[model samples]
Target: MSRNGQAFERYQKINDLFNRRKGEMAVVTTEEILQKFEISERQWRTDKQKLEELGAKFEYDGRLRGWRYIEPFNFSDNIPLTLEDMYNLRLAVATLAQLNHIADFKDLPQTVNKIRKAVGRWVDHEAQHKAIYFDPLPQYEGSRHLPFFLDAIEKEQQVQFDYFSFQAHQPQNYRFDPYFLRQHHQRWYVGGWSHDPNEGFIRTFPLERIEGEPIRTGKYIDFACKPKGFNPITYWQHVIGINRPARGLVEAVVLRFNRVQGKYFESQPFFQPYTILERTEDKLVVQMDLMIEIELIRKIASYGHEVLVLAPATLVEVMRSFFAKAAEQYTPR
Candidate 1:
């Protein structure tokens, strides 16, 4: 094969190795390539740089003691997904459908299926695992908030809305400092400051809860005033959910996992760098920070009796009151 053909094949194998052991250790050495592909070390380095120019990036970290790869780094870097890559994606999609997924689509299913079948059969649990990571969230069916928010975002203006909160029986007018339109699960949320007289500061409001036309400010304020170098996820690292992300310092959130359902809580945490508080033989006490979006926490709790709100007394009480009222329906009604 020509030099370019040989380099491309080597890149494919490298990508496959990294993808297979995602989040695990992967090593690349001159010896391995020379033995496996009958190529020299000089040739490999040249090809590695070529791949980097093609938008592939990997970093050498002395702490992990190995190189870390960022995959599919470019969808437009002159590198098309290979036939094998397409097959893997297709296989994943099929397996996800089997997992009681009630996914809906408008028109691309038939064509996507045809393309997938033309690739190849995916192996065993590989497809299933890939599916779990690759699924897309459902889109909003009727989103009226976008136009209003878009106008305000573009104009750098403030907005006021008639808001109806879940616990509040009556609607209230709220002027806000809208910063972001965050989408969690399948719903859209606005995170900003509320101009309430008593507790006048920032808060979050779901788009669906807004009752009337939004009043926009004709003024401008710099968004750079907030922490300029921050990831919302990392910034709110201890947040129990995304409904309300802690503005600055993280708060500790302790949760109790229900007996039968606690295992689900053990699956993937909302954030890393968290400590597992206490694990009795029967139940698990999982504690993290309370900087996550509140809506995210509620959605996780909606999994029925799997998880319980333990601390912050306020959140626990909120859940307690909600479930108490819900339980009343079963009391010989």
Candidate 2:
């Protein structure tokens, strides 16, 4: 058989295993697998892996002499939805409704609608609407281009688009292999590999400022163009928001917040690798190990007198300069 033929046979075997598993009540016995599938244990293991890749949960039971789904599988009857499940569904519907743009996600909106119709009688619409609400963010002008970028990422293709650079005071053309899309503070951002300025570096662009349309360039040969050890998740792990951190090693930042502010931090700690060094009646001292980016500086400064920079003198100076500039802007010349 040809390569395509072999692939098709494998797919058929995996599908057959899925159907058999779906029918079984308590577990799928080894005898059933051997008689129906007529495959060796190793081949069965391979088929199991393929099923798992397709999101089918299964586990082997020695005493039962069979495999069972991690969660009970019931295809015929409707699974009972608890009040908590209804609440989550409500939030899902609300969030999907907010994304007015992007026509590709039509099925998601429809699914949310179906969920609402199914659970309408049980769930309290008005109370849940008030209690769990996702605040709307600024609508992106070029949000229609989201599909094009997503396609490029899926297919490992390069894309071209016109972007408005605030610093340059003009629109510039960009061509790069689309990597990942991230949402921060209700804003969308795309991170990718670009070779415009130098050899190449991973960079991020705000989706809102992405002007014109995204043109699919071509397929990206990952090995040749991309850096050997580049992983977007690891690259942006230590930083906050979309902006790159201050050019240096990640530092340990200690801050003291007043009682009111400390209470807020205690409730919702922002950065990861966070630790509360000391807590007292007067203030709360917390430490976070992360890159000292401009966004981080602004966040700390936003607290004004409530937050004080205890360590990392450089960040403290940045904070001081930030406040001084603000004061100067207000002072008469």
Candidate 3:
């Protein structure tokens, strides 16, 4: 075989070894690879270099006496899925179907069956019967827009769609470069740079409120010069859910939850880096730094009386106004 062919064969075997032994044990030691592949130490070094180039994050640990994968990494483009990988994909599709209520990827079922057949494993009927499940919430209308928006993002093109505005009571035509698609509280959102000359800032559009299909404008965006500090995910990370604050400010929000509700948050926190200030039999006080948005108020209101906003006097007043209005609605006139 030519040198390139030999290198490709070596890389494939190395990838298979890594995939098979991943998480169960580490066969990443120099000595181990040398023994398993019957390669010289110099060749093993070359293989390690190639793996790193292909996006495998392998870090050497003196304590473990072997290299460990910092995260799950896969390099093969068209390789058959491992049994575990196929099973996880199946669970993911089922979960998406349950949650979104829209079959976004039309060929997902067929693709999954193909993966299962490729594995050629016996059907563990008992195991399959008692598998993963999801208590999915109601369907989001915008879920159907996922595929189109994704295609637009991939193609780096402009899209025009009819956006319905609840406040305006009419649908308006909007043209924008679809940059990112995100899910917030089970609702899908597409955000990107608006083509309107007057408004150059980023804007997010709710999928549910989209009036019709998104049409491609046949215009391309040169992402090679895409802004230096632009990251769609990072842009909304600090904001509460999907609402981007008009006057964006990240402030410390202290909340006190009742014991019952607090226990739920202990396992699944509202946001990461939440510091537990006080934990008692009756109440649990925690704090998180987040951007103030209307969605933040909605989230607190969802818990009703179980959660109380303890700090940032501005938020307290907002919550107070919210409750007073709520109280009036419940009160007899």
- Best candidate according to lDDT: 3
Write one digit per residue (lDDT tens) for candidate 2, span 36-110. 767787767776776566556787778768887775433323334557767777677777777744555556777
lDDT tens readout by residue for model 3, 1-333: 767667777788877766666663564777888898899999888878878877877777786677767776676753445567667765664564454236675666676556445544533542458566566577566788888999988988888999888888788888788889988777889988776676666778889999867799875565543446888858877876776764668888999999999999898886788899999999999998888788788889989999999989999999999999999988986
Candidate with more favorable, higher TM-score: 1 or 3: 3
Question: Which 10 consecutive residues of model 1 have the lowest summed lDDT?
Answer: 98-107
RMSD in angstroms, all models?
A: 11.8, 10.0, 10.5
- Each candidate's number of clashing pairs is 17, 0, 1
Q: How high is the CA lDDT of each candidate model?
A: 0.62, 0.74, 0.78
- What's the TM-score of each model vs. the native? 0.50, 0.74, 0.69
**Can you write out model 1's per-residue Cα lDDT over 1-107, one digit (the tens) per residue?**
76656667777776655445456456554565568667777877776787677777777656655555666454233555666666667656665444232223333
Alpha carbon deviation, residue 284, candidate 2 (Å)? 0.9
**Candidate 2 total steric clashes:** 0
**TM-score result, candidate 2:** 0.74
Look at candidate 3 and give me any clashing residue pairs: 142-207
Q: After superposition, how far is residue 33 of candidate 3 from its true place, in Å?
A: 9.7
